[model samples]
Target: MTANFSGDNSSTDLLIEHRREIADLLQRIKNRRLQVFGLYATPIALIVTLLAWAGSKIFIWLHGDTPTAVNSVFAAAVFILGVASVIQGLAEFGSGSPWEDSETSVRGLKLDLSLAEEKHVLEARRHTPPVSDRQASYKERIPGEIARLRKESRHYRRLHLLMQWLLFISSAAITAVTAWYDPPQPAKGALIGLGATVTIIAAAAGYFKPRERAFNLQQTADSIEQHTTALELGISPYSAAGEEENLKTYAATVEGLRAEQRMREQQLDQPQQGQQQVI
Candidate 1:
């Protein structure tokens, strides 16, 4: 009876350990999803508010001094939107809450760690007495799990693209309406120039959306690979002789790539900041 109790206690301990690991892994996944949602949603909201402001301003300027209560209300609404956008952008920029892409990488690491732990547990279970086969099917579905994650990532990318295009369309429409209402003349050259600048910015954003998505996807994938390799090396005790070395090499390569990307982003952002300052 003592031996039976000891065996049951060991089994219970293993079950508790597994459950704890699973719970941690699930929490990381939830956090990652939230981070991605915030990344896309926050930017889109700001862009829409900016476009509304720009559109209303252009309309008011085109139809000067004919101000009715409706126009005043519309202008107030646009001003409110602009103020809200500034607040939201400041919050996002200051807190860096929504742009927490690193959290996704952390979650990927947790998943990889969970997987390695699972492998260790399975090996231990195999060496011990027979257990039920219920968990085997779930383990076998890892490919499906990966596929689902990839699909979700792609969906987020598509949503980001859609938002970019919508911003571009709205900006373009505003510019077009402004030009139609008051064509380019020497007297209103400044207004025409402002409209042209807005249109150009919108066009550039639309053009760059695909490139940005590609870059972000590559970065995210590289992060996942690095995290996975690190977790595998850290957790798996019985890996092949060179597996640890390989993982280290993989991680180093990914880190180098990420550093290069950061440098490039900094270079790009500097000029944009300078331009904004000048403006």
Candidate 2:
């Protein structure tokens, strides 16, 4: 009897340790995700500032001596406007609480599991609803959340595209005004037009291309929520055990999706960098 009791205690300790390990892993993944999101605004901010400064210089060169003070004020206003746009973009990109959103889903699953475990321990609990009912509730909430996230993503994408096009149009208009007044030497005019055309094309492509990793991360989170609910309700018996398995699956899927997204983002960055290099 003594040996049997000792064996039981040891098994219980091992289970506790495993649970702690899983929790740690999940926390690490979440931290990494938050860090990645926080850094996303930096590059856009730099680009906006650089473009504004370049545009201002071009305007000055084109206008020459006429209304010098007015031109300077206009150039300063354009720079300020560019800075404001960058600030606005950063706020929009980061304001959605993506990390919080993901964490909320994870917390919901954890709560359900904790309640289920507590009921199992109590044994005398008679009013507890069946797992199936709990699962159904989860499923009902998930689709709405997924739909909301998809809508928001689409809206932001469109907004970003609009901003890119607006920047290109503004740049072209400035260039045209400058050329009309200053009339760049034939060779210079040709080069300027070529450069502006290339920049616009590059920006358009970057804005429209699918952000593979971000899309993947979002889908993975949704899938994890769905699977967690299914597993808890015994509607779908996954290969792995408990909430930990669901979390692991979700993290793995997110990592894979993020990798692809990062690759695409890098590709987008390259063309912009190349353009800057030429300038």
Candidate 3:
């Protein structure tokens, strides 16, 4: 019964099939990157918080009182634990795209195809899902696209702020601690964790570049809105006599912008892409 419903794919069908897979793989790669970052970042954040709590307690205990043998013991313990945690984080999460190599290899597998390999793969890929016939009109979808892009823009903007502020606060804390006074041994050991925190945070920032994402998303949304407005007003290129043609123009422009936005995001997610200046 299953075989009866399935049709063998020709070269053309295989081309379409591979193209769709590539697009889906690209999206999955981005998702994988985010998941890996969160996986490492969450624990690192907890470690940082714990270090701050420990440091605060140490400071409060030492503020006016003369440093005692007991205080040194406690500080040493905190220093050992905090520094270990931070080093672990830097080792694991210090930021080029994690898990990206596997995905890239998968993509390479897809690209390095042969006629024989394609045939073998096609034998298993014959089961194609039915494409949906019902679709939302541009009128129904454009507003939603505009809204989504704007919302994502805001989300990335907030992320940018959070990462930036964390880096700033970490840097200032490190500097202030160094300049304030000569620290006794235990406190100095604990402060090393703060420095490591800054390294991890900077690595995350450079890799993610959330500011670039926010800007690109907002730019795409704005361009889409501009096209939408022009289309509705029937002005210039959209001034075609037929409303259908005007709508077509708007759809093309909006989709092109959306595609560009997705490309920009892919660039942001790739560490090597960071070397190139973002558009």
Candidate 4:
């Protein structure tokens, strides 16, 4: 029941080469994106952690018997850095995840190419037609792919949003404890931890962009499912066409949707902020 991407007897080296080239390009792009993300996260996390841990000393330096205003200036710098990190983190988050997107593209391409090869084999074997079991294989396979995509999309979406909400609640709790409750030294430490956590979460969320990823995945999956349904029903493109022709049409439609998804991911990779960052 497995479909091989290695083409049928007529497949040319040029075609296989082209597909490999595309896959390689996608992998490179994904690697570059992950590097960029790591570059952004590392320094931000380190500096923020340092500032949070030194909260007690900084507070003492700012408020205690220090005649000079140097501590005030230093504290301001830390605050600025923290804010900047949050902004950058969020920017990176919405910029899209090249790794997952690339994986999706490469996966779809392989499946599409394998299906194409399968069609060729079936066409060639017309004189000695395959069994009904062979025909049933593809019918079962397409839905399985659709289900996998949907499940993965939902998993990321839910995990990210859940984390974001939890951080927000933690932030709220810290703000409330410090502003209204007049906490002691131990409680004050919690405020510093809160600031660090929020900054990290903000940056992480920006980079992760779970909601958009999930939405795009769901859309692509739904589009493919629709086409599958149409072909099964013998609709316009699928009707009056031979099995091979119908499959080509289906592959074309699915590929188009996947291309759209790629374009959308590219657009997201840019530094978008303000209202655009909400989702």
Candidate 5:
């Protein structure tokens, strides 16, 4: 049963190709997770500050002329939270790259792939049922990637909902304060601050386009899922004469999907026009 297969060149090249693809997938997963973290974390920080400030205001109303310790504690909490929100937003926007950790993993994997010699690859091929096993492995990879994108899309959708709530609540509060209270100078300043806060949040939402991004990612993931399902069912392009032929179809189609996903990710990374200042 010893068929004289192309020994080193073709097999090694194929291994390298799959390794690079998996590396790219790892990178995509990492970037999307970081994107979810930053997108949601910034808003959570701001929301915490709002809640704490409201609580402090209620405390002041209930017990007028509070002690210095109480005032100092509230002031300190606000300061810390404000600083945290600013830092997180800056890190997310343009100040830092969140993909470094994933890139490190990719580098290590590539090194291992490079070290794989002809005999080593050949031995692996000899031991394994080549076409079916490799096709199954490839099939396994697609779902994980699609799930990652879908998960990130869910996070962004939640964020979009929360931002809408923030905008409405802030607007309502400002309107209520204006109608109900003939505010003193300080109260007027507070009202103005609330208005500014609402405006900034709205601007950020429009600039960031989390809703749109969520929609786009979800659509992309769905498209990938469809292709993967078709391949699994031996439909259309995936209907091949043999296991090897089908494997080629599967690999090529998956690579095309991955490239499309990468392009979408690049679009996600770029700041949309007219949003630069807000960004």
Candidate 6:
């Protein structure tokens, strides 16, 4: 049976607007973070480029071959441009991301939404008579939570696979490039640095262990699905003569699975270098 959760039109509209605003704000925050990261990375990129350029220049000097007028002018211009860019990036990066205001707003809106939702629920209960305890659960909670778990699992799975491929490809490229250029050229050094960047990223990914998160989430999702299907099919746990008892069992099992998944995620988030235990 479907659950009727709506209150009055106005309250329903307010809830909808609140959700829309929250989504928009979250998107804005994500975009802002990306922008800030780009700004912060710019100076590091400039330094790497300058280091490569200086190395190339040093190699030329060691050969006792002076640069042509045009080559010297070009190198000078490039160095000056790189330096200016580095300064600009450093200045902007020091200001850091302005996340405080937006995050504060998000928190305020969430609190308001919680209070409004509680009031809305009370209004709904007052207007519509008492409902079956399972009405909301059977109709909304199970499906929503299952969908969320599936989506989170997929997201983490994809991230883990992508990072795994990066680790593999970067290691291969580093070896291949080193063999390809026996000479110590700046270009080769820059390529090696790029490969090291991938290694660093892979190390960070390892620490986070998206694979474990995906495993735990998928396991929880599968568990929930299995119990749901058994409950619907009136199998062992649900075979009892009492419908309420079956529903209670299903609720308890699903909650337990969810709690376990949350704990697994927290353990994965710890700041350790060791392999995470996938529960």
Which has the greatest TM-score? 6
Highest-lDDT candidate: 5
lDDT of 4 by residue, 1-279 (tens): 123344432344444554565566556556556655654675666586667546745676556654346557656666766786665555446556433332233446556556656654554454233444344445567788789879978997897888779797988988787877565466787777888888888887787777787888898899889888998999977795577667666766776887888777765676676337545
TM-scores of the models, in the order given: 0.32, 0.28, 0.49, 0.47, 0.50, 0.55
- How far residue 165's Cα lies from its native spot in candidate 5, in Å, is 0.9
- Using TM-score, rank the candidates from best to worst: 6, 5, 3, 4, 1, 2
In angstroms, how far off is 219's CA in candidate 3?
Answer: 0.3
**Worst window of 10 by summed lDDT in candidate 5:** 98-107
lDDT of 1 by residue, 1-279 (tens): 999779867876776677676776676677666655655665576577567656766876666654477567656666765675565555445656544434346557566667957865884675454322332332244335435545655865776676567666656666666667665454366555555766765666654454454555456555555455454555442244664454454445545655665554454445566636644
User: Tens-digit lDDT track for model 6 on 1-279?
Assistant: 123444445555765665676566566556556555655565566677667657766876666664687467657766766776665555445466344332233455456556666665665555543344544356357877888998999998999988888888777777777778776474577676868879787887878788888889888888898888898899977799887778877777778888888877777776664224343
Candidate 6: regions farther than 4 A off: 1-118, 124-131, 273-279
lDDT of 3 by residue, 163-265 (tens): 8898889888877777774763545864688789889988887878878888998998898888878876878878888766666666677778888888877
Per-candidate Cα RMSD to the true structure, in Å, reads 16.6, 17.4, 15.2, 16.0, 14.5, 10.7
Q: Runs in model 1 with CA error above 4 Å?
A: 59-61, 65-107, 113-117, 120-124, 127-279
Better of 3 and 4 by lDDT: 3
Q: What is candidate 5's lDDT per residue for 50-165, written digit by digit as tens? A: 77767766865556765678668767877776786666556556435553432234455445445554445565566454566677778778888889989999999999999999
* Better structure of 1 and 6 per lDDT: 6
Q: Each candidate's lDDT (Cα)? A: 0.57, 0.56, 0.68, 0.67, 0.71, 0.69
- Rank all candidate structures by their lDDT, best first, as comma-separated numbers: 5, 6, 3, 4, 1, 2
Task: At residue 30, give the lDDT of candidate 3.
Answer: 66
